[model samples]
Target: MAKKKVILFIVEGPTDETSLSTVLNRIFSSSTVKFQVVHGDILTRDFTSTSKIITAVWDLVKGFMGNIYHKNDICRIVHLTDTDGVFVPDKAIIEDKTIRNNAHPYYTETQIRTPKPDSIRERNRRKRNNMGKLQSCRHIAGIPYSMYYFSLNLEHVLHGKTNLSDWDKVHCAEAFDLKYGDDPNGFIIFMQKSSFSVCNDYCASWDFIKVGLNSLNRFSNFGIELPAVSQTR
Candidate 1:
């Protein structure tokens, strides 16, 4: 008998699929479990408005195992977006309507505790200018943290330096016009470099993928193989 296939769907971003693939292959190396990971091109601030991407993902998953296997097969779809105070509404739409018909599980999210859209640019610019001063202060204070989170050059709810609480909303990474855009690739790097990325929803999705793949590896039927080449970067 042929082995069953599992489809791992992800939202488009800088987060390398290679990491997920590598982890999956390792867990299922001895098992017959097979997985085909695909990404949905829903990268950007406009992702919430792009209902086409949602429909496309549903169509693909629906065709994979048909409605009959919908409840049986482990097809899954995950989306990561900017919370920007809009995550609740965005997720509600996907859960209640957009992907409600999808046979597989569907999820969406946004960054948490990020600077609001209106202030991200100014904050980044201020951070860039104050890097020298902040680095010096880090030595003096014997603690290292970016001054962007609390600086007069940037906006805040309090005087002198402001923390996360004063902001009215968080902005999507893309809105900052950062070098890497909002893709997981850049987000992953940012997550690696700063404390902020840990709070973001994108990393959470990646972590979940790791968990799902690990679970699937134990089920002895899918033939999973590692990627021929590992990450050099």
Candidate 2:
């Protein structure tokens, strides 16, 4: 028997894996579905920059492939990321001294309130440039690659809320898993019919997200990647 090719998913956290892994595994049952959790947004990480983003991604794939899988064993790479209002204008960032800590930056449809507004502005600049670079990236380490976004975040897109606490994230993920785990096709249908789902055209979808405050609003192009199934299915 031939070995099943791997469809590796790169995501920022375990909650992403928890929320979508089972449904993805079932959707692409002919191949092996695996997730690499990078713990934080790779685009905004201290060690990464726009110029080094491709190499940084290559390193991530290499690290995940260590000793166990050959490059040829992988079918494709799917990178899932949160927009976090990265493309918003600097004026959309408001300084709120009452925010108390730098770790939590409050996000809304029109503005991001943070104690460190300048830092948030800088972070947005870096992340926007990095995302533009990644969007144009077609391949990494000789494997096909594509990146998708959940804005203002995965929780916002999936659960209709943002700024969720760690416990809330876990709870929402579990609920999502239960809803879609057994019926993978149902998950695809939901994505396809969602208000946040972008057009099927990949370039057009990315283009839509970068305009105005759309990045701060709920939007995702992920449904474009799902396999097309007949309505009768």
Winner by TM-score: 2
Q: What lDDT, from 0 to 1, does candidate 2 have? A: 0.91
Q: Could you tally the backbone clashes for each prediction?
A: 14, 0
Name the lDDT value of residue 57 in candidate 2: 88
Please provide, for model 2 over 1-233, each residue's C-alpha lDDT reduced to its tens digit, 9 standing for 90 to 100.
99999999999999999999998998988889999999998998884788999999888888899999999999999999999998888899999988866787999999999999988988988988999998999998889999999998788999899889899999999999999988887888887778988957999999999999999999999998898756313
Q: Following a full C-alpha superposition, what root-mean-square deviation does model 2 have from the true structure?
A: 1.4
Candidate 2 positional error at 181, Å = 0.7
Q: Estimate each model's TM-score.
A: 0.26, 0.97
lDDT of 1: 0.28
Please report the TM-score between candidate 1 and the true structure: 0.26
Look at candidate 1 and tell me the lDDT of residue 190.
35
lDDT of 2 at 148: 95
lDDT of each: 0.28, 0.91
